[model samples]
Target: MKVLIVDDNQKALVIAKARLGKEELDVLCASSGKDCLEMVRKTTPDLILLDLDMPDMSGFEVCKILKSDNDLSMIPIIFLTATDDTTNRINGLDLGAVDYVTKPFDPFELRARVRAALRTKQLQDQLAELNRNLEDRVEQRTVEINQLLNQKDAFINQLSHDLRTPLTPLVALLPMVLKKIEDTEIKKILDLAIKNVGYMKNLTEKTLQLAQLNSSRLQLKMEKVDLKDEIIDTLDSLSSIFSEHGVKIVNNINSPIQVEIDKVLIKELVHNLISNSVKYMKDEGGITIDGFQNSKDVRISITDTGIGMTHDQLNHIFEEFYKADNARHDRSSSGLGLSICKRIIEKHGGSIYAESQGVNEGTTVHFTIPL
Candidate 1:
């Protein structure tokens, strides 16, 4: 450790330097407070032994100036006094002195105090270095995570594109081929092929959409839209499915509720929730689409008389590819529907959750949209 001894008396400086030098420390001597400050500016010492009485400036004043500087404030200062005066010791300490050493210093006491001060400074420096290293590591890890996510999104997009390229031709030609065929067995096989192709197309589209929703690349196109009209439009689009399942949709939202939202995403949200409800329902049941205006946002609920889920099932309902008892084996369900709905609502700065009593009861899905 480097130690600087500042004293107006040349004899005192020499004596102090000789005593501390024996302890394997680099001892630098200054004849006055001004010289001490000047030397400190040139080379910062780890510890300072300042004489209380000086010709150029008092040790208290020099201490105050050093402590005020952010760069030099951390260097420990020890006041060297001729007498054990209580007031002087307190004033020196208040000015940021680490400890006080009486004049005609004892070699043992001086060396011990200097070691203690240097040890504390070493620990503080170590801690600051650790904090800086931690910050760098956290920043590096964040960049790595972001890169990995981008690569994953790109792979999903490319795969979806590749799958759709071949399915497109089959989707269009298989239906026409089935229509022209007269043989019953041949027509049945072509129809089945068309259905499977259609399923693949749907799966590709949903997977691409889900991947986009999960990534940071997707941006919401916000606009003011009528909530009732959006819900009505979604119901119209899925009208055939509801009819096929013999399910009734009761639109209970009467008011023209206006909300700032991404129109396409909100429509998809309603479509997925409503379609999912019908899928799990019995042959004939009712789906109630209800909404109410609250202070901060609008709350909508889709209640269905379906084969209700248990508490555990409701907990994982929004997870991607998570299927309940019936949906687990049901090929018709891609299981990404509700997961997309959840992402849509969250992107709109809203929340979504489900409530189900138990099996053979019912399920209600609640979602919110900000005003």
Candidate 2:
């Protein structure tokens, strides 16, 4: 350890150096606070023995300056004073002095105090090093995780595109094959094959859309959109399913509500929520779509008289490929529909949640988008 002893009295400085000198330590002497500050900048000692009274600067001022500096603040300081009064000692310690050695000092006690201060400073340096390494590791891991996610998205896009090419020719030929066959059982089997192909196509499309939405950078084509018109258009598109299920949709939003949004994405969000409720609904059940606005946001809700979900099912409803037993039995659902809806809403700086009254009662889906 290298210790710098600072005092205006050269004799006192020499005495302090002699007392703390040992085979393992080197002692540096300074006649004034200014000399001490300069030597500290040139060679940063492990610890300092500072005298409170000096011609140019007081020890209190020197301690404050050292403690405020980024590089020198970690070096422990031991104040050497003539009188050990409570106020002087407190004032010195308050300015970051680690220990005090009074004049007419015991040589053995001074050496002990210097040893303890160096040990404390060593621990502090170790802790600072550990913190720096931890921060670097966390930053590196974050970059690695982001890179892996990008690769996964690229793979999903390629897989989805490749999967559709072969299906197109097979889909066009299936109908012709059915017409060429006269046996009723053979025709039914061909129809089933066509249905399964359609299901696969839908699953692929949904997967591609989900991957795009979850990418790190998502851009929206923003414009002033009439939400009522969007909802009406979506309902018309799904009119066939509504009729087949004996489902009626009631739109309570009468006004032409204009909102800033990406029209295509909002339409998809509405379609997914409405279709999801339709799938679980009872015969002759009804669906209601409503909207309201506050100062900072707009809220939209879709409520249905459907076979509602249990607590556990609702908890995992928005998770990708998470489905209740009924949904698992359903051929129409890819289990990605609700997941897509949630991602779209969140991308618009919005939130979505589901509410249900146990099983077989009803369910309501609510979403909010920032204004």
Candidate 3:
């Protein structure tokens, strides 16, 4: 590789060339900064060995010019100096020299520094090239993956439509048959199967909704929604479960706060929170739904006096497929509810967080959506 040695000191330049020459480097010498610039313009070298003190312009000036010029910026420059002062060393380094060698320098150390700089430059070049290639490959793969995903989504939509068309008749017939059945045990079994089938349909619908939300195909119909009403509706939907568990619902939503949000998505968000509360609450425990409007955000909190979470559980509650240790024991949940809630809140320029003192100490899930 080509190397330009720039220094007014002929002895220093000769010694540097002699030491670096043993490695068979193509060394060119310049006695001043002006000559160094001319030499660089004439032939761009891979590296430059520069002297801090020069009769004409100093090495620092040359380094500054070289660094500022787009054409010369990539070439590494190493400074050779006699001064041991901290300021001069910092100034030299800040001017973009890769390494500073103090004089009268050890020849071996100088050679080692040069070799190390060259190796670093080579590695950097390789890394940059690899990154460019990797990026191109990644972009191409992303396009291909997206194409495949679109095809898969189309297939799923078609399959769901076709399956539901046939299932509609069976779903309608099941209830009629159950109504006429004389055996109570058989009728009960059929009813449970029908209920489970309904649950399956709900899961499929939720899955489709999640996919649409992920693909940015789900357009939210935003409107000024009364948060209090939304919370009440969600609570009403979970009334049966709450009653079954002997849990009391407390509404502290004072002074109805209106926030611009998609009613459907907000309903889902509230439903998930309330459902979770109901699922985890101890027998006869109470759940409170509260809302208030701050200056630029409306904050809603669902506080459940239930089998609360640990600090670690609270930290990961919103992660997809992340159920608390206690919740995992049931294994009945898909664990997508809180994750979906997080996505919905974030899509509306909001944030959600879970807080707990500790296990069995109750937990509060708070979310804020901008008004």
Candidate 4:
């Protein structure tokens, strides 16, 4: 560090020069406040010790002038005076002097304060540097995330448009050819082939929806919607699936609850959860859709007595293409249903999570939307 000491007495200057002879410091001497200010602009010392009583200008005056300049304001200043008047010392400090030292100075105490001031300045500089670095890192990561999202959008578009187009013709032709077939063995094979194609179609649609959500392409048509009606309509759409699996719905939501939401998206969100419950279910099970409102949000839960997930499975159920161990090899899954549902809920400024009492017990999915 470089320290600049100013004094009107030549003897006092000599004494300071001898005391501040420690290593790693370059000391500069000024005979008056004017000379100190001038040397400061050129030398830009890290710390300054100024005599409070000078010929023309007091140290308080010098402190004010230094602090007024933005470039010099951060430099630490300490006052040196012969009088031990508490008011005068406080006056110097009020003008922004970092510390005060009485004249006929104690060398050890001056050195200690100097070291403390320098250490404090070091920490401040380090913190400022860290803030600058953090800002730069955040900006860089934002650019990278944007680039990745753009590439994901392009990939999903190609998957939906280019790929699904070819599969559509094959799917349509396979069904028509099956209509003309008479052999049971051949018909079964064609039906199996059609099922695989249907899975592919479902996968493509889910990918498109997820990609659109990630790209922020979906705009919500926000309106006050009848929550009960939406749930009933969504369940009605999937009634055939539930009937096929022998899954009865126990809708505990008795009253109508009004909510601000996008009707289409919220319906889809409900449909996905209910369908998942019925999809993995065996014969003779029940699915429940219950809702209630709190002060800040309206909460809903879907509980099902189906093939519940293990802790490991529950952890990854919301992730893309993450099927539980039981359903990992099930070719019917696009592995994107829950992921799409999660994205939809998040878009509405809501949250969703799942809980399970291990495998074969039950699973409950809960979600909340702001009121």
The lDDT leader among the candidates is 1
lDDT of each: 0.90, 0.88, 0.85, 0.88
Q: Clashes in each model (backbone N, CA, C under 3 Å)?
A: 0, 0, 0, 0
lDDT of 2 by residue, 109-184 (tens): 8888888898898898899999999999999998999899888877877887698888898778888898899999
- Candidate 2 residue spans exceeding 4 A from truth: 64-68, 83-94, 106-109, 172-186, 217-246, 253-263, 292-299, 327-329, 346-351
Residue 130 in model 2: lDDT? 99
TM-score of every candidate relative to the true structure:
0.81, 0.81, 0.61, 0.76
Query: Which pairs clash in the backbone of model 2?
Result: none
Q: Which prediction has more favorable lDDT, 2 or 3?
A: 2
lDDT of 4 at 348: 86
Ranking of all candidate structures by their TM-score, best first: 2, 1, 4, 3
For candidate 2, give the lDDT of residue 126. 91
Off by over 4 Å in 3: 7-16, 30-35, 38-43, 51-58, 80-90, 100-113, 119-152, 168-200, 213-226, 232-250, 256-260, 271-288, 292-371
Candidate 1: residue 163 lDDT (0-100): 85
Clash list (residue pairs), candidate 1: none
